[model samples]
Target: MQIIVVSRHLKSARTITIMPRHVLGALAVFFVLVFLSSAFFSFISLHFRLPIVENILLSVQQQETRQTRDYITNNLNLMATRLGELQGRLLQLDTLGDRVSDLAGIKPKAADVAEKPGQGGPFLPAPLSATELQQEIERLATAVDRQADDLAFMEFKLLEKRVEERLMPTTLPVKNAVFGSGFGYRNDPFAGLRSRHDGLDFAAPTGTPVVAAADGVVLTASYHQEFGNMIDVDHGDGLVSRYAHLSAMDVVESQIVRRGDKIGAVGTTGRSTGPHLHFEVRMLGVPQNPATFLKRGEDFARLQRR
Candidate 1:
């Protein structure tokens, strides 16, 4: 590049030649200075509220902040509602547990464990704070956990005791059957003399099903001289039930059986005049009145239903 310089001081003219590289360098420097100056002015204008674009950006940022806060509040409220529902259910279970314990005649000593599992206070027409709700949720959760464990344990113990009680010879061996002969002394049909009858007799038709009185193990199931097609079930704690004069025996020796299990069929297979079932309950080989045990069992069942 070349530039012509005119100097009128001495009435002379001079010509200067510039290299392409130097000219390009000078142009580059000028462009860089212009860019820096433009950037500085832009920043100053935005910082001093000199542009409408800046105001719009600030408003968008504020709106986003409010929306975030609202979102957080909504989420907290939802969580609180779910927690309240759980707490309500827990309360019902607690009440049911207490009721069952009273019915079973068992009381828990650790009722006031950790915290009381109940709700009470003044009713206010206002929303709860997030912090307060969170704390309440924690407290309720703790109480429910403790009570649940306690109730589970209590239920197990009661269930075990109930099962033990049921596994006794306390129910009728024949279902809905009437007694044909009473216990104690009776005139023997074969001997024609007063003899002691050790058991009650139910006059049922041949093949009338006879069930077990309670849960027990079949100790003996065989025929005898006086009792035909007999079955003896050994209940726990030295209690036993005998069903005699059956046409057929369904259970074998040593087999475990539950209450109401079909153990035999009714028939007069022994030295009797008619088809009947002889039922006897004994404790440690000592005979007991069958009516006493049956009555007690019936009463207990009625109480449970209520």
Candidate 2:
């Protein structure tokens, strides 16, 4: 390619030669630079201004954050509810265990069974942080585990105690009976001399039912000259209860009987007394104090004194 230049001030016309490849190369370079500059500026503007794309991205991120928070909150609430239920069950177990211990005459070791968890005063408390809540939950879980162990041990002990109590003489032999002759030294009406009374005499009407003191098997249910119609129950561990001076016997030898079951009816057939029941609690053939085994209820205590 050839280029011609005319200079009117110089009054001269000149002709210069140019290469086609060189001109094309220069045009290609210019276009390349323009494309690069345009791309750089477009990237800068997109980064600074972002438009609706930025809002869309932010919305997606916010949704994800909200979902994460809700998931955490829901799980925390579930855990809290479960923990509350466990605590309630633990409290119930404690109450039942205490009652059983009372019946067994066993004292409780820990006094904190009635105490509640840690509590804040009237001041408003701040919400626990994540770490704090987790720590507290773990602590509560450990406490629940410990309580479970204790309750299991207590339940086992209570069951053993129940078995033992059933085989021991511990209740009244006659219902609504007044005290007649007490245990120990007293004047014998028949002999007219000071004699020893080995059992308590409960005066009742004729044919008043006499119940067994504890769950046991009848050892002797026969008539004797000194006892009239009588029944003796052999509780386990060398313990026995005697219901003597009866008008009629309801149990036979070797018959199983529970506490409060009718064994006979009261009578004065034995030695001359009013219609009465001669109740005796014996261990190894030796008489024991009936007051020592009777319950400590208010009415029973009054009856015991009477």
Candidate 3:
């Protein structure tokens, strides 16, 4: 294309020719330069690890990495703390187990039976290369085993003592009566002279029912001159009890009787008395204080409830 230009200030006129190839080539080169510059900067940023630039960029990356590491460490620490708590719980369980075993009368060796879970299977042994925490848990388990044995023994002894006490004649042989005469020597009611009284006398109306004071088997249920209509019960554990001066007998020889069971009636059959039941409690053929065995109100009441 041709173009004419006129400059009025200089009064000049000129003809100019325009070329499109050079203009197009220049515009393309300019665009290429912009693209190359951007690509170059990006490459330097990625590959050429320049210390100052890299450090600034790495600061943010390092902060993120540090936060991640700290979070992992905190989690690990929390886990360790929880594991320690579990170990402590295991120790407590061991101690409790020992106490229970002791009360059960089971031998330490026999504890193997209970050592395993009740659901199924034999005992599980800890591995040789166990962790320190696991070893501590095992130690606690062993301690519990020993304590269990002790508890079992204690329980057995307590039960035995309770049985023995129950078998003792430690309450009123017959209900609702006062001690007319206590054990030991007092003026004989018949002769008015000092004589040893082997038993105690409870003053009650004649024909009142008498009951056995403890569990025993009747050894004698026949009449005697001094004892009148008498019943002698032999309580085990080397003890014997005698009920004398009775109106009638309710049990026979070789018959077993429990505490509070009817044995006979009270009467003035043998010696001179208005009417009374002669009750005797003896240990190994020697007379003991019947008053000690004669529990009064509420104390014996508690026993009967049991």
Per-candidate TM-score against the hidden true structure: 0.58, 0.55, 0.56
Residue-by-residue lDDT tens digits, candidate 2, 33-105: 9999999976876789666657877899999999999999997887777667767866786677667667656
Best by lDDT: 1
Ranked candidates (lDDT, high to low): 1, 2, 3
Residue 168's C-alpha lDDT in candidate 3? 77
Q: Candidates sorted by TM-score, descending order?
A: 1, 3, 2
lDDT of 3 by residue, 82-104 (tens): 55676676567656655655665
| Model 3 bad stretches (over 4 Å) | 1-129, 296-306
- Candidate 1 TM-score versus the reference: 0.58
| Tens digit per residue, CA lDDT, model 1, 1-306 | 688888778577788899988989999999999999999978887878775868877899999999999998898978788687869978887897788778777765673445757998998888668787788788888878887887787778889878877886666677656666677888888888999888888776888898898899999999988898889998888988999999999999999999888988999887778888898989899988787777766632332110
As for candidate 1, its clashing pairs are: none
- In the order shown, the candidates' Cα RMSDs to the true structure are 9.1, 14.0, 17.2
Report residue 238 deviation for candidate 2 (angstroms): 2.7
Q: After superposition, how far is residue 71 of candidate 1 from its true place, in Å?
A: 2.1
- Name the TM-score of candidate 3: 0.56
What lDDT does candidate 2 reach at residue 15?
86
